[model samples]
Target: MMMIELLKPDYIFESSWEVCNKVGGIYTVLSTRAKTLQDAFPDKIFFIGPDVWSGKENPLFSEDENCLKDWCAYARESDGLKIRVGRWNIPGSPITILVDFTPFYAQKNDIYGQAWCDFQVDSLHAYGDYDEASMFAYAAGKVVESFYRHCLSKKDRVVYHANEWMTGLGALYLRKHVPEIATIFTTHATSIGRSIAGNNKPLYDYLFAYNGDQMAGELNMQSKHSIEKQTAHHVDCFTTVSEITNNECRELLDKSADVVLMNGFEDDFVPKGNTFVARRKKARQAMLNLANKLLGTKLTDETLIVGTSGRYEFKNKGINVYLESLNRLTRDKNLKRDVLAFINVPGWVGDPREDLIARLKSKEQFTTPLEVPFITHWLHNMNHDQVLDMLKYLNMSNAPESKVKVIFVPCYLDGNDGIWNMHYYDLILGYDLSVYPSYYEPWGYTPLESIAFHVPTVTTDLAGFGLWVNSLKGRFSELADGVKVIHRTDYNYSEVADVIKDTVSDFSALSAAEIKKIRKNAAAIAEKALWKHFIQYYYEAYDIALRNAEKRLAL
Candidate 1:
């Protein structure tokens, strides 16, 4: 049952949003999976990210100033980039560093402008700006470059595994300077697909016609195609979170990667059996109350509540698509099932509200009761204007009868409500079915997390998880009705409706016994896919890189 001892890596350098800092799914991947790497590689694995400077206003860093300063100096002198390295006394962990290089901030700003500056500031804020996407990638690259330079001078035989485009620049920089050093680039999600999805434009038009390259250049970041092309041509090896991303890179960037390492979930974090039963009961009750209050309907135990939650980006994360599909499903008399859609998307200040208005308009046309809550934050740090604008849009739109309620929970609930819950992994373990119709997902962690909860998940072929799920469908089907992969080839309203209708219809007929069987199968599959099994992939990748370096040395 120990499926992870297959590949062992020496000196695995994982640069991601995780470890001490977190931004999105990339953070989850690194932090949740770090212990597994440490267990497999011992002190050989190094977790690297920007030494986020958060000590000024916070008491957390005030207590550790002296140590932070000393470590910062050592990191700077050692790496030559105002860097800082420190270790948390966690067991079986690598030397974690909160790198501080504010001195270099101006230089980066001169190159990347205020966008980068805004992103850096947002990182310190309680609620991060997901749209300020470019800064972390550039900063992470700088960290990697500095780390690689420091390691090289010490004659370290290391395999540099850079996560996403943020750290891909480090691998590229190292390859140019030290070709013998092994380097791998992992693109969790492509910039091109994200832009297209978010902007509601065609990928080709977004890349070539629209001024994406020009805009990115102004920010000192590479266009999606350019980054993929450069990483593919230069790095010792190129990997992606999912096979879908791999194919996208190959087709879109005209370059091939060496591997497609599917993303995974932490088995230890997921609640199981009786523990999950209690949590599920609470979540179900909370959801029902909210649904009844908003939709004006008493949801029965048999009412199917299809849940979807993530960072609230309208087009790209498929929020708009999901809403449109719900509108259509509710309108279809034949498909008129007592289904409640729990959308757990938190509103961001700069995020577009126009899409929300459009969805509200469509929901007005629906006859079946719909309950939609647009969650907002009341905290002082939140953008007041954006919240007001969202409220304004909602007020101006035609309100459906209380049957279709749009409740805005403005306070932060730490996963108590099924919607806008951070601890969705806990909630999903109790879910009958989870839906992820992402227009762009590098390697989605939700589907895998759902699988771990023994919940059948619906993901798109565009996601990295979808690719892996498709690969393991036969194996998983034997155990239970594993993950269902939907094709996201079109983004038109009609097309999205068809996909959602098909998915809901297929899921509706599942017998409770069948669902239980599938849940068991999903858990078994997830057990094998845990970090324990694949942390070695990092080590093995490093070994390949080091071996390649040695062969080059011989030549």
Candidate 2:
């Protein structure tokens, strides 16, 4: 087989709303994938993110004033681009620029007007976080622009990649100001597509018939749609995280991706050999201990641990369906073992439950429930909390004699949630099964992460990861295959719930040997999704951008 010669850039500057700030899946995408790029590109790559932390101590960042002291000083003095040069506290520890965009709020109108004039971005209808995100993006563009002009050469091949609609303005700004630099704009999910799906609209079936501009108007999403659509059209190599999102782009943004950059991860996040086993054991014990203390149950190692985790979009993230599935599973007589389902989505959490904390500390295992035993965290409004409300509606008490129980962990498990002091990944490894039956997942990282930790996952064909799994198998997968990609549709909530119920019930009955094989298969599936394999798509994207930049330069 002949190797393809991809265009390698002399310098690469990538910008995102989630670079070092751990907001959502994009943070995982960038942080996990950074090791591969750092290895390949060495010192040629830089990441820019919004300094939302301000002067507060950010655990994710390690400031290095001396590393880029000259540029930091120059950029601040000359451009008013308040930036903190640091290394992100991830595997690669890649150079990161966290720009304070507070200073740019005063210039918001001028920036919006300039974007409108240059790229036809209709920021006139902007609202809420639009101005904030745009100003940050604009600042990132100026940050890159100043860095490029001051510290870089015209002869050096440079590519500026912007992630999501939040960074679309930066890509547009770079194009208008620094045309010498190639640009790539990646949209994980189209603004209109997510809006359509999140609003309970039939997205896939009605996708082609839906006009983006029309939907943007109806949904009051004109500003975001305008920026995203215009950026996709203008970028040298427009990309999406998956093929499904690319389809959304074709219909919603009227532009096809030059390449699909499938999100991938480094295996360094997963523990090795004995450490893996030890950690998995500890995680399981921790979870079981928490459940036993909270519910006052003797849910031992025999219990089947299951969970669903992601951003808490009640309908879109399928928290509703996950709860419904667990509710259905509770009644299924086929469930051979006690199933403990954890709804690990963060919400408007007030604090950790004091009663639960006290119970967790006590040696006595009281055989009774605590108040609001379903959740470990105290939410601001228990009445308005969707997960708790759904639990109440389903009558899903952590009742004794029930075959299954659901627990809502409504806080970020950052090693100090006051309940289980384990990080999200460490806590998640305890699970035998994970589910992300998403209604609007562009790329499902939660399920992918599950499989990486040798945990079988149940996701939907509506998810890009699920589709990719099916493609690998050439047919729909089952729990035994490490990933069970359920068929999910807008109208098939009940059917999807039943499938998850059945899947979890079946997963509970697998023999130890069968379970080991399935776990191995899960690891194998995750290996195929590592950045070593998936980073080729990024190379392809770079080649497209560089060649396009060359064409523009020639003219």
Candidate 3:
């Protein structure tokens, strides 16, 4: 096949479920990469997302009525579109349009019917968040269609890009309504692949055997898988985040990605020089103070602060494996340093530790351990929580005698989680090491973020980022070299845990100068994963989408 000539889009409109909503990894993907796009396109690039932050103040969105006032008013009066145009509060402050998708719920059946009619999208076996996501996606599509019709001309080469299965409805809608506009669909992780992994099935091993539609029916993921699979086949250019997920897209979605658009991050959020040093110092002090008050043991600056943070998925995020490894570390008598391992996964936290707070206020460090000192915040279901249960099972009381202290921070550290009063990045800066031994991660952002903060991390080969790291190093990466890409198989939970234990032990034994060099190497690896380096993949996707669209239109 002869290569099609590449083309650039005059206008780009990207849509995702997490555009202004800081829900998950997609938020990081779109927000961080926005500046790079903004630099090239200026105001020509726009983001469309669901308006979930109506009554509450969304700190991430800075609303600007002047952005598309005439068009906004026209869309409202003429098309019944309710949207807020603004700038996302990231590096570039790219133009964002938040659509109020509430009204679409009344016409859900009609919308789904139209989708089925136009694109043969299967909503027959729909369940769970399918309706909600579809509605929002439909609304986003309506927003894009309205904008394009009112503002853009046929001569303008426009691209409508939708991210993930949650936003596939919008892409399908745009393709149906606006045939002239090129469409790009990027699935960060295929729904069926995640479902299979989340359900404790061996996805990677049996990836070839499981039919996408059959697994969708089996796992009760029919709706999401249907739309995702169809969108991949229909889009002008289909892409995934990494080579790992590109394989998943091929096997599970039954469509090979035109381009593998690897996720890239920006370092604009990170502090620098004196500010970085000061923040690190502050974070360490805060952590030590809390640990001292909770454990009744005076922790020093030399204490190794280790952490694992993400969504509280016990199996998938490798929180269970992390705990098991920490337990193994706790049993080791050769452990020289006191390890403060933080489980920063968000949960249903009740309140801050009252006793710890009182001690901090009174400047009275307790010589006796507080009740449930292993956790920073009080959880709603104290006895039922998995982390707490695991802690009890392992007898990790965070006592004075224990060399390893595990602290569960069961809340989001959004600068006001009551106990820490520090943002995640601010507090994570103090960590000596981070670990994300994920079993089913598409692209592990936690490990990437840790390395970006110059903290060496241990991730699994199951992670997309881990695979990318392996590609760079030409072998399984080690913590000594900044990233430990442990080969994690479905049945090797214990093996993975043991590897992590050994890695942490080795890292603990490293001299200060050695650790410094490792941290620098970690940051160096992070530099290569930056948007500046990885944005070219997205350009390739755009080029393919445009060329394909041109070919389709000519036909």
Regions of candidate 1 where Cα sits further than 4 Å from its true position? 1-10, 56-73, 76-84, 87-93, 106-156, 176-180, 203-228, 293-297, 332-337, 349-422, 474-480, 491-496, 505-511, 551-555
Pairs in clash, predicted candidate 3:
none
- Local lDDT at 258 for model 3: 94
Clashes of 2: 0
Q: How would you encode candidate 3's per-residue C-alpha lDDT over 283-370 as one tens digit per residue?
A: 9999989888887889899999999999888998999999999999988766778899999999988988887788777677578888
lDDT of 2 by residue, 1-555 (tens): 998688889999999999888889999999998989998988679999989888688999999989888888899899878899989999888999999988888888898888888888999899999988998898999999999988998889999999999999999998989999999999999999999998889998888899999999999999999999999999899999888888899999999999999989777878988999999999999988888888888998999999999898999989999898888887798999998889888899998988988888888978998887888988998899898888899988888989788889999989888889889999888999998999999999999999999898999999999889999999998888889999987799999999998888887788999999999999899999999999989999999999999999899
Q: Give the lDDT of residue 174 in candidate 3.
A: 81
Instruction: Quote the lDDT for 506 in model 3.
Output: 84
Residue pairs clashing in model 1 are: 4-533, 9-539, 51-98, 51-99, 137-166, 188-442, 295-403, 480-518
Q: Give the alpha-carbon lDDT of every model.
A: 0.57, 0.90, 0.90
Q: For every model in order, what is the number of clashing pairs?
A: 8, 0, 0
Candidate 2 ranges with C-alpha deviation above 4 Å: 1-4
lDDT for 392 (candidate 3): 90
Please identify model 3 stretches exceeding 4 Å from their true place. 1-5
Q: Estimate each model's TM-score.
A: 0.73, 0.98, 0.97
The positional error of residue 452 in candidate 2, measured at the CA in angstroms, is: 0.6
Q: Looking at candidate 1, what is the lDDT of residue 445?
A: 78
Give lDDT for model 1.
0.57
Residue 537 C-alpha lDDT in model 2: 93
